[model samples]
Target: MDGTIAATSKTDARGKQKDKSPRLRKRSGFVFILPWFIGFLCFTAGPMLFSLVMSFMNWDYMQNMTFVGFANYVKAFTQDPFFFPSIRRTLHFTAFAVPIQVVLGILIANLFNKKLKGKKVFRALVYLPCVLSGAIYGLVWNNMLNTDFGVFNYFIQALGGEKVEWLADPKITIWALIMTAIWAAGMPMILFLGAMQNIPDHYYEAAEIDGAGGFRQFFSITLPMITPTILFVIILQLISSFTVMAQVLALTGGGPAKATYLYSLLVYENAFKYMKMGYASALSWIMFLIVMGITIVLFLSSRKWVYYEEKGGNI
Candidate 1:
């Protein structure tokens, strides 16, 4: 009778353990990934799949998708003269704007990270440009940069220089765009500030004790400590840079002889303005491939320069 009771108790215990295991594991997994899973399906995965399907069909929102196989893609390469030019313009913008932003953001972030008087107010001032609407920002800058009466040109003239049409001339127009885009570097600046603050002061103190000057300490200690943040910011900037359409739309509009017609603008024009949905999708897919390839290359090459504090927590 005692043996029977013991057997029964063991069986019940095993059953309870089995039930609890699945429940605990399931709840943990759900808790860990609910947000990401929802975001991926709703925002990332769904859009990607939908775009993929749209790329194969010539749809204009008025008619059914007419399957054209590879014609749209072929035309983008072979028939479109604007395609290469737009790509070149985009590359130019990315190359020029990204480094400038990164350097400026880092500098500003480091500055704000230090204990200074009214630092919060200064940081807020720096970040003000990020909250403004693109069109509004464009209009404001347009008025401020106007050749005949804009405030900037007026100041330049007052400082013994001629007024320059910032947006009309090709050479100056691209530079104007670069300047405007750099203003939005405030967010990255804030991000860098946070990363810098998170870094322990012990590293800098140790470097100083070892006879390191400010520049040396910055290069050796500060840079390596914040490399992960740099890598993350660069990746995000690369992806975002490819889609630099809003500023171009408001400021340049492909401008004096199609100099600043970025790929995104080109895609938008073809897709919506001209009803060339299939061709637009092809352009978008090409952009996707370029971005993906660059990202993969960066990931593979990150071992050379990306210094991580821990072994496996790469951003």
Candidate 2:
């Protein structure tokens, strides 16, 4: 009888320990994460909620705080003259810059993957631009693209070609910004390289055994295998291109007759330059919605193209 009682107590204790273990672990995890959670509530979530509330008001960075409901949103859609133009400019940048960045990144990654002398040095140089601050990058490129005594113009002049106003020309300023964007394709290049390295060598061997050439192997094996990485790069580049700000602010200041005036510039100008804080908040939410919409579309469309090797199917 005593033995049976002791056994029951042991079982109950074990059960209690099992239940308490997870609770204790959960408590520790919460304790560890408390700092970040508090920070998010205090700084990020608080500010975001504040901005969302301000979007419905008519606060002009001063004493005014009249609630105007959907007036700001309606104004952005219909009354603001720069709205469509800025949206167009931002999308134009996205269309051109994202593809070029993806292409350049892939090509550079492929080149660096090959066995070559000083490959490590070359890789470092290519990724150098990504580590640079946006303002510094703009300042560097500003000098490089200058028509008078700039490196680009110096080369053109050397080849008996006329100096082209890369930034000063309204038509060319957007292209110049796109050029800077292309130069910053280093992060995607690194990502592509990592993805390419992860591809199984046996697939390439099988392709070679079937009498496939280099291009055939790349297209049939490498490109298909890396479609997942390509999708990731595309989404990242799209987001970056759409929300581009510091480079334009430092380089042209949306100058040359507002040719490079992007959507982000409009939001910034309204918020700080013009002191339309409420309107700027509305614009910000609109930008978030646009980006969220595009991201959703990309994710939905990815089912068609993104390949998962482990799953042996498209994502």
Top candidate, metric TM-score: 2
TM-score of each: 0.86, 0.90
Residue-wise C-alpha lDDT for candidate 1, range 1-315, written one tens digit per residue: 456555544555686756555654444446546679989999999988888878878777678889888877888889999988888888888888888878888999888877799999999999999898877887788888887889999899889998898977877887888788899888788888888988898888888789999889778877788888887888888877889777677776778677677889899999889987777888899999999998899888888888876577844
Pairing residues by index, what is the TM-score of model 1?
A: 0.86
Give the whole-model CA lDDT for all candidates, comma-separated: 0.82, 0.88
Candidate 2, residue 10: lDDT: 55
Best of the candidates, lDDT? 2
Instruction: List the candidate 2 regions with Cα displacement exceeding 4 Å.
Output: 1-21, 311-315
Off by over 4 Å in 1: 1-18, 21-43
- Per-residue lDDT over 28-77 for candidate 2, one digit per residue giving the tens place of the 0 to 100 score: 45655667999999999998999999999999887879999999999999
**Model 2: pairs clashing at backbone N, Cα or C within 3 Å:** none
Instruction: After the best TM-score superposition of candidate 2, give how far the Cα of residue 191 lies from its true spot, in angstroms.
Output: 0.4
What is candidate 1's local distance difference test score?
0.82
Clashing pairs in 1: none
